[model samples]
Target: MKEESSVSRLQIMSVMGLSKQRNYLLTQYLQAIQLPRGFGGDLVFEFQVSQGRVRHLVLDEQASSLKEQTVMELIRRSLLAWLPEESRSNR
Candidate 1:
């Protein structure tokens, strides 16, 4: 979803392969997070999958109108992107 290209898809697949190799659960049917395309126009989508199904799917229409919340989510995602999928303690 980051970029609509074959290379991006391949990167995602590669990460999934790495996750499996590291014993991370692969049962999540799908996982996605979609931020609003425009302010106050669309809902923010956050979907989490567990046990081959959706455990939570938050659709916040108001999030688009709340600049603070949107900024927080952006920051959170950025921070998360910087984190290792497996903590050092796991090794």
Candidate 2:
């Protein structure tokens, strides 16, 4: 399992290299998962579906830096705040 801090909004966007067409899909399902302990930071949840079965997994974020975690939180909040504006403009 990987740490949640190992991944970021910018990193996912970088990995997927989503175009304008797919950007809406990402924004549509933006989510946040927290660790069961509910002590420090967020957790990462991953789901996979195949020809056989689907699996659910949660990632840890124990050693993440304060700066590392906050940046993503800030970005997430900013995106959430901007979503309404984006929708209106897209119409």
Best by TM-score: 2
Q: How far in Å is the alpha carbon of 35 misplaced in model 1?
A: 19
Query: In order, what lDDT does every prediction score?
Result: 0.37, 0.37
lDDT of 2 by residue, 4-88 (tens): 6433322232313334544554455353322122233333424332222223322334533333554445544433433333344
Across 1-91, the per-residue lDDT of candidate 1 in tens digits comes to 4974322110123232234633233212112234344333223545453433333445455654344576446534532343233443444
lDDT of 1 at 38: 39
